[model samples]
Target: MSAGVESLLALLVSRGGGQYGYEPVSQLAHALQTASLAEAAGEGAPLVAAALLHDLGHLVEGSEVERLARGEDDHHELRALRLLKREFGAAVVEPVRLHVQAKRYLCAREPDYLAALSAASRASLAVQGGAMSADEAAAFIRLPQAEAALRLRRYDDCAKNPLAQSPDAGHFLPHLRQAQAETRTAATRPDSPSAQTGATS
Candidate 1:
């Protein structure tokens, strides 16, 4: 396995046992559940991998309790996306980066979405920037991965159920390795028209 993949697995094993902020499930459980949901939805490996690692930022930051205690947004999406970009293709990383924005976009477009959020999610929504403005939603929809991010966002929101059953975290090894290979191959194709522009395109 690549170093990045090994490191991520280790981190999940070591630090993801903690509570997922105020959620009823553990962080690891949430990740597994999200991946399970994505897989069940017929998403490909890249998306399933993205679903599994979406909240890795919270584990890396190691301060959810503290951040929420101080009412900070935490911005775990950026942290997780940074590390994801180092080892995974754009397909696995873009949704991680945009899932938060997708949440805002959904709230702006679907008023009922706000009411369905857990109390903690609702609280974080305020700090993460309340609902998006019409212009913001329009721009967000233009992103190539916006729909994927939205799908990931929905998985994220529902993955908090403590009663949900999920495969062990190790089950994602195939997906992660596949994503890593895709990233490594893409990095060598700098002149390719389909090559990523080194941003969340």
Candidate 2:
């Protein structure tokens, strides 16, 4: 496996057992559940990989997360995006990058969506800039990855159920390897339509 894949597996298998902020499930549980949902929804490989690794920044951000509980924004999305863009392409990385913003966008665009968020999600939403302004929401909708990011955001919101059974992290390795392969191959053949990500965030 590539170093990126190896490191991610280690992170998920080792540290992923920790609590995922205020969520009832462990980080690994949430990740597995998220990826499982994406797969069951018939999402493509890149999107499934995006679901699996969206919160990788949490594993990498460690102490910074403490700040979030204290009402600070940790900007974990950017951190993950920087690392992920090196190994995956825009299709994978951008959705992960925008997932948080997706929450804010939904809150602004749909009041019912905000009301439906878990208390923890609502709390973090405030720290994450709360609802977007009408202008901001308009601009956000135009982003190339906006729709994918919104889908990822939906999966993320639902993945926190402690009772939801999810496949083991190992079960998703093939998906990861597949995404990695496509990303590398796409780098060499930039015109290839199957490329999942670009070289930079």
Mind giving the per-residue lDDT tens digits that candidate 2 earns over 1-201? 667776776777797878888889888998999999999999988889999999888888654348876779887777777667656777888899999999999999998999999988898888889899999999999999999999999999999998998888888888887887775444533354433454332
lDDT of each: 0.86, 0.83
Best by TM-score: 1
Q: How well is each residue in 61-80 modelled by candidate 1, as lDDT tens digits?
A: 74877887887889999887
The deviation in Å at residue 90 for candidate 1 is: 1.0
Q: How far in Å is the alpha carbon of 137 misplaced in model 2?
A: 0.8
lDDT of predicted model 1 = 0.86
TM for every model, in the order presented, reads 0.90, 0.89
Report the C-alpha displacement of residue 177, candidate 2, in angstroms. Answer: 1.7
lDDT of 1 at 126: 85
Q: Which 10 successive residues of model 1 have the least lDDT summed? A: 186-195
